[model samples]
Target: MKKYILKPGRHQFAPSSPAVHINDTLTDTEAKWYLQRFPHIAKLFIPLPTEGEVSTAKKSKMKSNQTEMEQTSAFAPPSGGKAGQ
Candidate 1:
């Protein structure tokens, strides 16, 4: 049984983050061995508050960019689905 850390999106796994990948499917000894080799994984176990802060920061940035896009598009006339029209 392989284990993977996944993001909230459907059917998507995050290969990069270490905190989300711990799995019991692997034999206990094997899991221990892997963790021992990649000690950085242990360090990435983020606390709830920190995760919340990170998520909020990302949401704020996204909202800001979206607002800017909406403002810009307001001035442009709707092109009738023509390429570069």
Candidate 2:
């Protein structure tokens, strides 16, 4: 499977930035779309965002799981709703 490492927001694609970093694994269609949208995207390279990789990725997953757990817990009553009233 191919993996992409984008800068994570609209601000990262600012015009003043020299080139938008991209992963080499991208298919032709993906590359073409990025290039068309951001003309200055110079090169496709291997393994982007080496710094803070684990923390950044894990943080997203943690938040998502936390939210899901909270929602599920809210729907499920404690101890399956005791014996009766």
Candidate 3:
């Protein structure tokens, strides 16, 4: 099951369940139930990415950054000389 981090604050999942505090980890099922019960505070449940997802995101971000840098350098003006000089 996936994991989630609860936002800062105390929360009770159910009448019988004890209140959870900030930084508490919750399973995917618990998160889903909390969201359904408290849609108004849906932002409180932050999903944690798996190892594979994290790596994939990093790879994509690196690729995009590299592409941007290449594009920028391609349009850079010539150095050490003024135009039409």
Candidate 4:
């Protein structure tokens, strides 16, 4: 069964279910059942990523940010110019 990580805060999957706190692990079936019963908290259930997956995602994000920075800098006006002068 896949695992999911719950976001920070207390949550009750059901009226009879025990409350769960931040960083709690939930099985795939449990998460699906919880969502079906409490759709409002859908954002709170995050799929647990593997170690390699997390690192790869971080690298991709960093590369994307760097590319955006480069593009932004390319269009920036020369620093010496005074505004409305």
Q: Which candidate achieves the best TM-score against the true structure?
A: 3
- What C-alpha lDDT do the candidate models reach, one value each? 0.52, 0.58, 0.71, 0.74
lDDT of 3 by residue, 12-31 (tens): 65557777634546666767
Q: Residue 34: error of model 4 in Å? A: 16
Q: Identify the leading candidate in terms of lDDT.
A: 4
lDDT of 4: 0.74
Single out the weakest 10-residue window by summed lDDT for candidate 1.
4-13
Model 3, TM vs. native: 0.50
lDDT of 1 by residue, 5-83 (tens): 3223222123454343334333446545655776644433322346788799999999999999999987766776544
lDDT for 43 (candidate 4): 73
Per-residue lDDT of candidate 4, residues 10-45 (tens digit): 777666777773554656677777778888777776
Model 3 RMSD vs true structure: 7.3
Between the candidate structures 1 and 2, which one is better when assessed by TM-score?
2
Backbone clashes for every candidate come to 0, 0, 0, 0
Tens digits of per-residue lDDT for model 2, 1-85: 4444444332233367744444444455675576679665533323455569878988999999999999998877678586344
